[model samples]
Every structure is written in structure tokens, then in C-alpha cells.
Target chain A: MNAVIVENIIKTYGKKKEVTALNDISFDVSQGELFGIIGPDGAGKTSLFRILTTLLLADSGKAMVDGYDVVKDYKAIRKRVGYMPGRFSLYPDLSVEENLNFFATIFNTSIKENYDLIKHIYVQIEPFKDRKAGKLSGGMKQKLALSCALIHRPSVLFLDEPTTGVDAVSRKEFWEMLKTLKEQGITILVSTPYMDEAGLCDRVALIQNGKILSINTPRGIVDSFSKPLWAVKSSRMLPLLKELLQEDFVEDAYPFGEFHHVVMKDQSDEPLLRQFIEDHNNDSAVLQAARPDIEDCFIALMKN
Target chain B: MRTLKFILRKEFRQIFRDPGILRVILIMPAIQLLILPWAADYEIKNIKLAVVDHDHSEYSRQLINKVTSSGYFILTHYSSSYEQALEEIEKDDADLVLQIPDHFEKDLVRENEARLFMALNAINGTKANLGGAYLRTIIQDYNRQVRTEWIQFPRFSSETQIEITSSNWFNPLMNYKYFMVPGILVILLTMVGSNLAAINIVKEKEIGTIEQINVTPIKKFHFVLGKLLPFWILGLVVLTIGLTIARLAYGIIPAGSFLTIYVFAAVYLLAVLGLGLLISTYSVNQQQAMLLSFFLMMIFILLGGLYTSIDSMPEWAKWITRFNPVSYFIEVMRMVVLKGSSLADIKYHLLKMAGFAVVFNGWAIFSYHKRS
Candidate 1:
């Protein structure tokens, strides 16, 4: 069963409706599936989350959460869904335990009622339950926020950029928590700007500029890249990137970490590319056929 | 109802946790109440007099002695030149000038009438007017005494005097603090109630917590009530502190029962807190809410008749005071504190306050959208 369905949702902001935040967007998530929306800053990920969660209204389309219409049955949707906004939305002055207890009581439940669901995440921050939320480190605050969002045992949870500023270790731990929550049959829809996190999700929708570029499993997206990709690195990285982009056979080149990923127009032009790079400078250079990742697929999709 | 309980708990916990809000709620009222009443005294005294006596006769000296000894005027200059006295006025040294003409005391005995001229530096209108009135009363008393001395026998006198004795009611001593303390108490209550409530919701918005609250299933009425009830109770707490200070520091126990003030305050807080919530709903951030509250408060307090009489205001200004919630509370405070008015005596004001409470809270609830 589809836990969430969005059909051509359009939302615009400003007095004259000049800034189109979401434009003809549509997607769906099945029950118990961990879905992801992968994009960079200002890519309309937050706008889509707000619309689906019923915190915002779409200019011209329809959305449903847990079989309830986001517009007409907002009250029903609100009772069944959990939303944690992109920014830190918990009260800073409240202690961690107090914040959790407050959210739980307001939802007409108690912490002990759902302690088994959040025990793993809650135990990590349990020692600092008395400390104010504002004084907690970035990763700890995110964990506490997730706990508050889950205390009510919501069937569908929406997390917008939950791991944006968290450290590498905490991000991994947060994904692990989501995996456990999914096992208990809670459908989760999380948005993040990190391309590497896309592989962790069951499926991802690549979005940019208020539009979705591609929607599929991370491996499916990578397998769909139809061109030969190469990773070229030399002693001088900046000049190597500039030299590769100047060649007509090199379709696209962008600096990815330590190597410049080069998309070639022809699969048989590798020898010509390697000889041209070796002749450009006296420094030793290495070139290899590299496999496409989600970021490479995203870059390739964005160019089209 | 249970949602409201949890929300109230969170709000109160946040309020008590922040020392800044605690100081504003508790210590601010105490300090403002203690200092404002004594400084806002309206009884004008110490008018400086520059005397240019062209006629230094016994009658003139006697008049100067009488005027100076009245405890209202201080004789700052006693030169015989009128120009020097004018210089004194220009230098801000004297507020009034008394120019006695060349009377010589012969004109009073032979001509039976004498003329005297007075000049006042009317820059401070209240002080100049009161000073002129005081000098005229003293000269008239001297004239009556001189006429009585000339009358040799009481039987032949044809003068008929009607003596009028008047007494001040309610406050016989005409104490300024008695009039000022109640008004100041109302202002302090308003500052604590309205500003804090206005900033509270916007603080949630500024820090992004309001969006989380908005996604919850809690009813709008319950949410607004949860936001309002804590501040409403805190407002009453502030009023109690103000009243205690008025009693202990100023010795101003209300002439009427405390129940009347509390009843009126309970209704008054609803109106003001409703106004604060309305402002928060319209503001996007804490700075905007603070600025809007400050602007409205300045207008309300100035026109609320705290320092000026609403009856004496222009017709247009009087219309504005009718809509001002602060004005109604100030009137009720003064009525119950000074006039010893009962609850029945202020039923009209209570009804007006109840009307404000309905209009403001209703408008606030209507405009506050759960999804926008």
C-alpha cells in the first residue's frame, strides 16, 4: 500500500508569486519503505516535505499521507504523522528529558509507553537528559530531536535534512536508527543534501530547481549512466581539470574529491585522452576507468 | 484539555528557566513602582520671585514679606530696577516679577486706591499661573487689613462678609502619591503582561519551534489558551507585587475591597494578552514583535490618562481613549483605589473590558491559521 502520494504539487512564494518553490512535483512512498529526497541547498526539498506534512498548501495539486488528504483531512494526517523540520525546532531552554516528556504528553502518550521503540537512540543521550538542549552538541541535538519526533509512535515520519550538520559517526548512527525504525513498520521519508547518503536509502528522488531529475534505487541510477566515465589525476589537480575540459572528446569534467571525473563521448578514445594528458605536462599522471556513483549520475542527469 | 496542561507546563518551565524573563516579571515591577510615583508629582512649588519695588514704603515691604513667607515663592532678586528684574527672568533665575508702582502709601490714604503691576515669565505656564494667583491673594489680604484698621468702630461698619469653608473629600490631605500610585501600578502590570506575552510566541517562531507545534494535532484554541494562561497568571502576580509595594512603601491601601481590583484585573489581562497574541501572529520574528508592541504601548500609556486627564483631551483624542484597553483599566484602578467604588459602581467599565476581551481574542483566534 502507498503510505504517501503526491500529484503535481505546485507552490509559489512572494507577493507577486515570482519565486516558484515547488513546480509540478509528484512522488510516492510505499508502506514500510525508507524513501529519500536527495538534492543540494534550495532545491525545493523542504518545500515538498512541508506540503506532504500539511504544514503548507500547494498552489494547484493534491497530496495524501496515510490515506488522508493533506488539504481536507489535515487534522487526521497531523495525528498520524511526525515531522521534524530542517532547522532545529526543539525548545532550547528545555532539558532533553523535559523536551521529550513534553512532546509525549502533548500527544496523549507517555515516554514509558514507547520506550522500547526509541531505547537505542534514547540511551546514547540519556546521560545528558538534564542538560539544556541548546547547550548540546550538533549531533546530540539531532538525536534528541529524532526521539521527540518518534515518542508519539507516528506511523509516517518526515525528517527534513536531519543529518545536515552532524558528524560522520553520528550520521551513520542516525541512519542505523532509521533502519531499525523501518523494521517496526514505520514509513520514513528523509531529505538530505549529501549525495553519499543516497545509497543507504531503499530509493531516492534526485531533485533540483523545484523539479525532480530522476527517481530510482541508487544502483539503478548508477547503472543507467550510458557513457564511459574516467577518473584522471595528475600531480597538479587544478591544471589537469582545466586541460581535460578543453578537449572536444571529453564531454564533461568536474572535480570530485581528489580526482577529476571525465565523461567521454566515445568509449574507444581513452588512449588519445591518456596520450594528450601525458604530453601536456612532464609530471606523472594516472588515468583509470571509474565506476559511476549517484553523484556522477546526478551530474549527468542535471546536464541533460 | 490535557494538551493545554502539557503546553502550560512547557511554557512555565521555559519562563522560570530564563533569568532574564524572571527579572523582567518580578524585579522590573518593583523598581518601576518604587521610583515612578515620587518622580511624577504634579503639585508645583518653589516659584522664584524677582521683586522690582519702585516704591519702598512700609506697605510695599510688608507685601514682600507676606509673599515670601507664604512658602510658595522665594525672593531671588530685590533690586529697584525693572530692567535688572527682566534680566533675571531672561537668565531663568526668576519665574515671576512683581513691579510695585510709586505708591508711597499716600495714595492709599488720600486717593483711597493704589495700582500695582506684575510681570511673569510665562514659559512654564502652570508655575506662572499659580505664582500670579498667589501674589494677588496676598495683596488683597493686605488691603482688607488696612481697611479694617481705618474703621474706628465696629458698629458703624456697613461691610457684610460671607465666609465659605470647604473640605476635600476621600483624600483630605490631597496627597499626590495617593493619586499617582494606582495609575503607576496599572502601567507596570501592563508592561509585564503585554511585552512578555508578545515576545514569547515570537521567540518560538524565531527559533523554529513554532513550526513543530503547528504540525501537531493540538487544537488552535487549546494552543492559544496554553500560550495565554501562563502569562495571565503572571500578570496577576505582578499586580499583587505592585499592590504590596503600594501598601508597604507608599502606605496606599485601597479604599475598596481587593476583590474588586482582582476581578477587574482578571478581565483586563484577557484583553491585553489577546492583543499580545494578535501581534505575535502578525510578526515573523522577535524583533518585529517587540517593535510593534513597543509602538502600541507608547500610544496606549500616553493616552490612557495616566498623566493627562482624558476628559480634557480633544474630541478626536477622546475617541481614541475609548478604544484603549489601558485607559479602562486605569480608570477602574483609580475608581476602586481612590473613590472606594464597589463592583456595581464600575459595572460599565467591566462590561467594556469584557467587550475588548471578546473582540481581541476572537480576532486572534480567527487570524491564527494552523496551516498556512
Candidate 2:
């Protein structure tokens, strides 16, 4: 059964509807599935999370969480779902233990009751249980927030951009925690702007401008890029990108890290492109046949 | 009930952890209560008098001596011309001028009547009015003295006299602190109660913790009560400190029972804290909440009849006092502290304050939405 379902959700902000925060958005998440909503900043990912968490009302639509209607059975849904806002919303003045204990008691449960669920994450920060949450480093704060969100043993969890400001190593550890939580049969819905994190999710919905562009497994999204792609790097990268975009057979080219990823319009051979680049550049250019990643598929789908 | 307890625990922990809040709650009241009453004294003194003694007579000299000795006036300038006295007034040296005409004591002996002219700067209406009244009283007494000296044999004289005696009730000494301390106590409690409660919720909103609380299954009533009761208790704590200061520092033992004041204060706090919560719900951040509460508090305190009597206010302003909860609490404070009024006497104020509590809390709860 589906753990969450959203249908035709439309939300607009401002008196004159000047900003469309969520525009007719729709998606669903199955039980125990690790779902990712990948988008850049201001793509209405937080708005969607707020709607599902019952902290906001959509302009018009229907959503259900754990078989309870979001509007009609909000109380029941609130009891079973956990939400971690995009910002660190825990009380900064509260110590780590006090913050966790407070959330646990308010949910009508004790910390020991759900000790097994958050033990791995809690043990790391246990030494600083008396330290105020505000003074903790960014990664420690994220861990505490996750622990607080999970203290009640929620059936479905919604984390909005949990890794946005966290460091690289902490971001990897946070995702691994999510993997363990999923192993315990908890369905998690996490949103991040990091394209690489998309591959770690069971399935992802690539959203932009409040509209979902594509929802598929990361491998499925990369496999759907039905064009030959090549990565070309030269000493002069900017000029090489401009020259590659000017090619008649080249469908698209964007500067991706050190190399320019060029999408061919047809099934063209790699050496032909290599020879063409060597003709333009006096001699120092390396070209290789490359496979598309989620970012590449995202750019391809966005362009279409 | 359990949720409320946990919320209260968290709130108290936060309140105690922040030294800024602790200082505002505990030390601010002690300092304000100790210092405000002395500065807010209503008895005016040191009225600078520029005397234009044109008469130069025995009676005039006697009158000048009497006025100068009264403790209210200071002889700033002794001038022979009214113009000099006027110059003194223009320079802001003298507050009032007494110009005795050229009588020479002849009109008092032959005509039995004399006139003296007095001119006051009148820039400060209260000081000018009181100074003029004091001078007139002194002159009246001197006139009676001269009449009695002329009529040496009072038993044979046919002149009739009326005597009046008055006594100040409740406060025999007419102590200004007794009148001011109770009112100031009420003001301090109002300020602390409303401002703390106002900032507490908005602080949560500012730091984004309120959104996390809203998504929980906790009822709105429980959440608001959790936010309110801690500040409500703090409000009462401030009142206790203020009352102790009033007794120990100012020697003002309330004429009424302490129970009456506590009963009234309990209801008054509900109304004030409700107002704070209402302001918080309407505001989006701590700064906005603080600014709005400060604006409302200024209006409430100024019109509250603590500094100014409501009876003397303009008709429109009097209407505002009727709606001001601060006015009701101040009146109740004075009634209990000065008049020794009991709970039975202040039932009307108690009922009105309860009504304010209902309206404010109801509106606050209605406007505060779990989902927006």
C-alpha cells in the first residue's frame, strides 16, 4: 500500500497570487521506499513537504498520509508522521538530551521505548548530551534533528534538505543513517539539491519551477538519455565548450566540472568527434565516450 | 495534560538557560520598583518666586516672610520692579512673581481692605496653579491676623467667624509613596507579563521551532497554555518582588488583605498574557512582536490613570480607559492597597477582566492555526 499520495496539489503565495510556490504537483511514495525529491533552491520542495506534514494548506488538491486524508484526518496523520523542517528547528537553548526527551514525551512515548531505532545516531552525540544544541557543529545538529524526528517511531518521515549545509563526510554519514532506518522498515522522503545524492535514493523525482520533470529510479533516468554522449577536455575549456556547442551534429554541451559533456544528435562514433576536436585544437585535447548520470538526464529533460 | 507538562518543562528550561530573560524577569522589577516611585512623586516643590515688593509695608513684609517660609517656594529674585521679575521669568529662573501694590498699610487700617497683584509664568500648569494657591492661602491667614489684632477684645466684638477642620483618611500623612507604590507595582507586572509572553512565542517562531511544534499532535489549547503559564507564573513572581519592595523600602503595608490583591492579580495576569499571546499570533518575528507590544503598552500605561486621573481626562480619552485592562488593574490595586477594599468590592473589575481574558484568548486561539 502507498504510504503517501499527493494529487494535483496547487499552492500560490501572496495576495495577488504573484508567486506560484507549487503548481499542480502530484506524486506518491510506497511503504519502506526511500524517495528523493531533487531540485534546486526555491523549487517548491519545502512547500510540498509542509503540505504533506500538515503545517500548510494547499491552494487546492488532495493528499493522504498513511491512509489518512491530509485535511480531514490531519490529527491522525500528525500522530504517525515525522517532519524535520529545512531549517534546524530544534530549540537551540535546549541541551541535546533535553531536546530529544522533550520531543519523545510530547509524542506520548519514552526515549527508551524507541532506543533501538535511533541508537546508532544517538550514540555518536551521546557524549554531548548536556551541551546545548546551538553550540554543536553542523553535522551533529543534523544528527540530533533526525533523532528527534524519529523518537516517536513514525511510519513515514519527511526531511526537507537535511544535507543542504552539512559538510561532505557528514552528508554521506546522514545518507547511511537513512539507509539503516529504511532497513528497519521506515519509509523516508528526503529532499536535497545535491545531484549525486539522487543516485543513493531508491527513486527520485526531478522537480524544477514547482513542476515534476521526471520521476524514476536513478539508473532508469540515466538509461533514458537516448543519445551518444562524449566528455571532451582541453587546456582552453571555455573556448572548447563554445566550439562544441557550435557543432551541427552536437545536440547540447554544458561545462560539467573539468570536461564539457557533449550530447550527440545521432549515434555518432567517438573517434569522429575526437578527430573533429583535434582538427580545431592544435593538439592537446582528450576525448572519451561517456555515460549519462542523473544530472545529465536532468539537464536533458529540463531542456526538452 | 502530559503534553502540557513536557512543554512547560521545556519552556522553563529555556527561560532559565538564557541569562537575558532571567535578568529581565527578576532584576528589572526590583530596580524599577525601587526607583520609579521616588521619581514619579506628585507633590510639586521648589517653585522659584521672583518677588516685586513695591508696597514696602509691615504687612507686605509679613506676607513675604510667610510665603518664603512655607517650604514650597524658593526666593530666587527680590526685585523692585515687575519688569525685573518678568525678566527673571523669561530667563526661566522664576516660576511665579508676586507683585504687591503700593498700599503702605494705610488701606488696611482705614478701608479694612487691600489688594495685591500676582503674576505666574504658567508654563508648567500644575506648578503655577499650586504656587498661586499657596500664596493666596498665606495672604488670607495674614489678613485674619491683622483683623484679630485690631479687634483686641474678641468677646465684645460682634464679628462672626466660621472655622473648618479636615483630616486625610486612609493615609494620615498623605504619603505620596503610599499612593504611587501600588500603581507602579501594577505597571511593572503588566510590562513583564505582556512583554515576556509576547517575545517567548515569537522567539520560537523566529528560530523556526514553532513549525516543529505545530506539526505535532498537540492541541492548540495545550500549546498556547504551555506558552502562557510559565510567563503567567513569572508575572506573579514579579508582583511579589514589587510588593516586598513596596513594604520593605517604601513602608507601604496594604490596607486590604494580601489575598485580595493576589486574587485580582491572578485574573489581571490572564488578561495581560492573553494580550501578549494575541500580539504574538499576529506577528511574524520577535522584533515585530516586541514593537507591537511596546506600542500597546505605552497606550495602556499612559491612559491607565496611574499617573493621571481618569476623571480629569477628556471625554474621548475616558472612553479609551474603559477599554484598557491596565486601567482596571491599576484601579483595583489602589482600591485594595489604599482603601482596604475586599474582593467583594472589586467584583465588577474582576468580572470585566475575566471578560477581557476570554475575548483575548479566544481571538488568539482562533487566529493561531496549526496549518497556514
Which model scores highest in TM-score?
Answer: 2
lDDT of 1 by residue, A196-277 (tens): 9999999999999899999999889999998999988888888888888899899999998888899999999888888888
- Candidate 1 ranges beyond 4 A from true positions: B102-115, B138-165
Interface RMSD over true interface Cα atoms for each candidate? 0.8, 0.7
TM per candidate comes to 0.95, 0.95
Q: Which stretches of candidate 2 lie above 4 Å from their native place?
A: A269-276, B103-112, B150-164
Tens digits of per-residue lDDT for model 2, A164-250: 999999999999999999999999999999999999999999999999999999999998989999888888888888888887888
Candidate 2 on B1-372: residue-level lDDT in tens?
A: 888999899889889888998898788878888888889887879999999988788888888898889899999999689999999999999999988878748788888888888898888998899889988988888888887788576575576668788999988888888888888888888887788898889898999998999888889999999999998898888888888888899888889999999989999999999999999999999889989998998899899988889999999999999999999999998888989999999999999999999999999999999889
